[model samples]
Target: MKVRVFVTPKKGVLDPQGVVIETGLRQLGFAGADQVRVGKVIDLVVHTDDRDDASARVHAMCKTFLTNPVIEDYTFTLDEAP
Candidate 1:
């Protein structure tokens, strides 16, 4: 199975990196871009044929190591390997 995870800072949390990127964009003549927030997308393959089991495992992974539950939020999707 394939799993895709998206991790991002929680709302109201100060994102210094995001701020820098936003500032850089405006300086480079990107006027329409605003409130740019940076996040991460992780893609990996898990050896499982059952969707439920794969989802459960991925959820566990997220809670245990993938996300910093206090200041970050995460979401994941599971699919059959292509």
Candidate 2:
């Protein structure tokens, strides 16, 4: 199975990178861009066919090391490997 994880800043947390991006966008004439939040995407392959197992493993990974529980949130998706 393939897993894709998205890690993002939690609401009410200050995101310096996101603010920089938003400011740059606005300066570049993207006036409609607002509330931009930056995040990371991690793509990996887990050798399994069971959706439940894959989900559990990925969830553990996220809780342990893939995300900062105090300030960040995470979500993941699973699919068959190409």
Candidate 3:
């Protein structure tokens, strides 16, 4: 299976990186941009039956280490391997 994880700053958190990118975009004449938020994505391939066990393990890893809950929130999507 392929796992895709997205991690982004919380709504109330300050996003300096996003702000910088947005500024650069404006300077480049991209007026269509209003807001930009920087985030992280992780893609991984794992073999399993897609059972609760495998999903639980992945979630645990994400919670305990893969992300920091203090300023970042995360979500994931799973799909069959290609």
Q: Among these predicted structures, which one has the highest TM-score?
A: 2
For each candidate in turn, the TM-score is 0.94, 0.95, 0.90
RMSD of each: 0.9, 0.8, 1.3
* Number of clashes found in candidate 2: 0
Better-scoring candidate (TM-score), 1 or 3? 1
lDDT of 3 by residue, 4-78 (tens): 889999998999999999999999999999779999998887678665666787788789998989999988888
Off by over 4 Å in 2: none
lDDT of 1: 0.91
**Candidate 2: tens digits of C-alpha lDDT, residues 18-41:** 999999999999898899999999
- Model 1 Cα lDDT, one tens digit per residue, 1-82: 8899999999999999999999999999989998888889999998989998889898999999989999999998887857
The candidate maximizing lDDT is 2
Candidate 3, run of 10 with poorest lDDT:
45-54
Q: Which scores higher on lDDT, 1 or 3? A: 1
